[model samples]
Target: MKKENLRQTSEKVWGACALAVKAHALAKKGARLESHRDLWVYKNEIAREIGDWVKIVFKLADSMHKNFYENLTTREDVLKE
Candidate 1:
């Protein structure tokens, strides 16, 4: 994908991750969460509590966010899975 499109797509992924983290934190602590990293860090618990697929999706979203800035993800990498 083009860099501009990648950025836009990554932003949308980041937004979804932020919302997911917010809902997770609110459910667990009744407070707001700051980072998408939390989801990956707690993937085991998330998988056990939510589902394995949720954890995988969160990880993918985080990767997309990182890729936007680092420019390390290729279209083939995205399409691989």
Candidate 2:
């Protein structure tokens, strides 16, 4: 793999990890807010936000892995700057 590709993959993995941590924290708070109606609404909003972030992280990870494998087979770097 090219150095650039490796660096990009590292950055993406780091970003995904950070997002996961944030989502986990939000989920914890959301769980805690389950009993209060007003707080539950806020918790639901936070849950939705966490879902969106998880989707983004999954997309990024999937794209990166797919491109990495494709590059391995085709020797063509697909992640353009």
Candidate 3:
């Protein structure tokens, strides 16, 4: 693989990992919020929103990975002469 392509792949992988970690942190926060009755309703709502956001983030990460693999597979076909 070309150096630029390798670099791009590495960046994408790192970005995905970072996003996953963020999602995990948000999930933990959401769970913590659920433990407090005074803030339960509001916090639960926020947690639900965070859950949705995490799903979207993971979907984006999945797309990035899929695109990276597709690009790798078709590198020769897709590259400019």
Best by lDDT: 1
- The numbered model that scores best in TM-score is 1
Per-candidate TM-scores read 0.65, 0.33, 0.36
Encode model 2's per-residue lDDT on 1-81: one tens digit a residue. Answer: 455566457446545544554455467664332222433244335548656665454445445555544544222423441
TM-score of 2: 0.33
Ranking by lDDT: 1, 2, 3
The number of residue pairs in model 2 that clash at the backbone is 0
Candidate 1: tens digits of C-alpha lDDT, residues 1-81: 456476557657766876876777678768655654565565556578878897778778778778778877666655452
Report the error of model 1 at residue 66, Å.
0.9
Query: lDDT, candidate 2, residue 81?
Result: 16
RMSD of 1: 3.2
Question: lDDT for each of the candidates?
Answer: 0.68, 0.47, 0.46
Q: How much RMSD separates candidate 2 from the native structure?
A: 9.2
Worst 10 residues of 2 by lDDT: 72-81
Report the lDDT tens digits of candidate 3 across residue range 1-81. 456574356346546544545445467654332222323243334447566664454444444455565554344422321
Off-target runs (Cα >4 Å) in candidate 1 are 1-4, 42-44, 74-81
